[model samples]
Target: MKRKEYAWAYLFISAPIVGFLLFAFIPLSYSVYVSFTEYSGYQAPVFTGTNNYAKLALHDELFWKTLFNTFYSALSIPIGMVVALGIAMSLNQKVRGIRFFRTMFFLPTISSVIALTLLWKWIFNDSYGLLNYLLELIGIQGPAWLSSETWAMPAMIIQGVWAGLGINMVLYLAALQGVPKSFHEAAEIDGASGWQRFVKITIPCISPTTLYILITSTITALQDFPRFQIMTEGGPNYSTTTIVYYLFQNAFRYMSMGYASAMAWALGLLILAITLLNFWLSKRWVHYE
Candidate 1:
């Protein structure tokens, strides 16, 4: 009977285990190997040792530019966090039609990504776009948002912040609701002002949620690619080109698969370091109780 039970357990897990070895582990191993060679997909890989990495480090000015642009665009993470927290607090209030407001705010998150990207592209159009038209009404001319080098990255950041706010707000709302009402009541009894209660009680209570949001937001920012593809195509002097976009260009456009794999490894290390740093720093402020 025990043998039969063990056989059944293995049967249940076998497919997934095999699938992971084939799809995940094998591909990962090959990618690491490929990073050390020079190859187009159709050609035999020629071993190049550390030349790909050396080129990225010493010769790739475009890679450096893309790295800077990616970090620069990550500014949206903080802006989104602040807006989400504020809206979440408002949504937590005992008010009529709050559910309806929440549903409306969350609508964009449920919409198709391609559709949303195209919609935002139109919204940032130079003359006929809604943003520019609104500016005309106010007697201030709006710049060509996605077409201008200076404004393209910021435009992408705005779209990202708007698109992400609803989900983060929902997470914050859940955290807020989980906070003990007794804490607030006690704070009031101690003559704590509203801001004081928020700072000392609510913020401390919801600290774990904040840390979760921050870490996820950073990871998302690091891998962002769709906005560049749909909104800017990393144009306007490649002002909006990010690391992923640069990787894609190297892999497909230049047929530099080895170079792209090296970039992927580098990006993976960067993300791993940042994630570990977040975890280490979180011990200082992420409250559990």
Candidate 2:
């Protein structure tokens, strides 16, 4: 009867587990297999061993360029997190209409990302746009934001931060509130100034939240592509061509399935390494108490 009960327990979770294996595991396994070959969706996959990887590592110029773009975009995550945390800390203080402001901050997080990107495209329009118009008010000429190669990635980064700030800010707000008020009071009694208290106590109390935000934000930024697709299409000389964007172009557009799979694996490995590094470093900074 005990064995039969265990069998029944497994039966309850079996369907979802089977679905995950079929939909996720099988595709992932197939992609890994395809990465070792030279298959263009239509042709029989020809095993190229490590030749594809060698090409990317030793010969592909675009590989490095895409990597740089990915890095460039990720820098915005830290900048956004810092700004959002500052805003959240202030908003967390006792104040009237705080709930309304929180909702306003979180509104962007719930909106459709596709719609937001389309709207930003117009906002960064070269000829006449809200951003350029605002710059004009200050007697400063705005460059073509999404069109200029030099400005395209920066424009996307800024838009990404603006759109995503609310979620991270709310997360920090929760962390801030979780901090025990007694600690702050004790520090004040000890003659600790505001800056010193925040640095020594508030930051330590919130370090775990910071680690979580850093890892998740870095992963999201590294994989960011949809905004790039809608805004720049990885163009203006491939300046915004992140690895994921290039993978999409190669897989769906050019039908270089094998090459695209290789790129995907490379990106996955890079993300894994970065995540591991973040975890390792968090040991020193991510306080639990």
Candidate 3:
């Protein structure tokens, strides 16, 4: 529009644009360069072409394991989504004490992640763990949750789901609340059952939020590190090591900055590809109102 309006708009947007270029694009470009070299942070990066990726792909068994574990742990996303949606539905009712229950459900999400992770670690301890103790009282045996290769990833997934349930539940609750009651009432007049109303009306109406949560949850799962690191240390046979954890070890613990940068680039590209795939697939399912 007007020149003065343009000037004011530019002034309002300038800081964030400058910040993003300086802090985001510049570092991203630098990391792309670093990924092609062999810099250990103490010395200049020596150009190495695709050796790092080749090494990671063909030679690093732990890399494959970590990659697998990362995807495997992400299995919690769908499970968490179902549970969250169920809880959100229940909370969407106009029942008494609903606000209090909502606050309690959301507390875990806003609480200290470190403290919660430490508590979960203790709860997974083989003998004295609250979980195993309860299982014992029920005449069921519990495996070494963090120590066993078979169970460690599941343990991490459980912690991830428990800690993350509140946020996703809140998201679904918001989406549910946005749905017009008239739609359900109209469907009821047509003799549509509760399940039919939910499936044909509610789901399509909230598909946008569902798609948003699914993509974000998947990306977050790919890069999740804190809970795994604090609770399992990538654990008893590297069974819990994820791609991000592997990248961290190579970057800081082993001091392989360039290699870690390569891993970072790979992870970024993977996330981009998956996100693109989701957006493309969304056209088939996600309906916006």
TM-scores, all models, native as reference? 0.98, 0.97, 0.94
The numbered model that scores best in lDDT is: 1
Cand. 3 TM to true fold = 0.94
User: Can you write out model 2's per-residue Cα lDDT over 74-151, one digit (the tens) per residue?
Assistant: 878888998999999879978899999999999989999999899999999989889999999999999999889889
Instruction: Name the lDDT value of residue 192 in candidate 3.
Output: 100
Candidate 2 lDDT for residue 89: 87
Error of 2 at 146 (Å): 0.9
Select the stronger candidate by TM-score from 1 and 2.
1
What lDDT does model 2 reach? 0.92
Off by over 4 Å in 2: 1-4
Candidate 1 vs candidate 2: which has greater lDDT? 1
**Over the stretch 145-251, how does candidate 3's per-residue lDDT look in tens digits?**
99999999999989888877999999999999999999999999999999999999999999999999999999999999999999889888899999999999999
lDDT of 3 at 150: 92
Flag clash pairs in model 3: none
What candidate 1 gets wrong by more than 4 Å, as runs, is none
In candidate 3, position 78 carries an lDDT of 92
Candidate 2: clashing pairs of residues: none
Clashing pairs in 1: none
Q: Rank the candidates by TM-score, best first.
A: 1, 2, 3
Q: Write candidate 1's Cα lDDT for 157-229 as tens digits.
A: 9999998988999999999999999999998999999999999989999999999999999998999998888
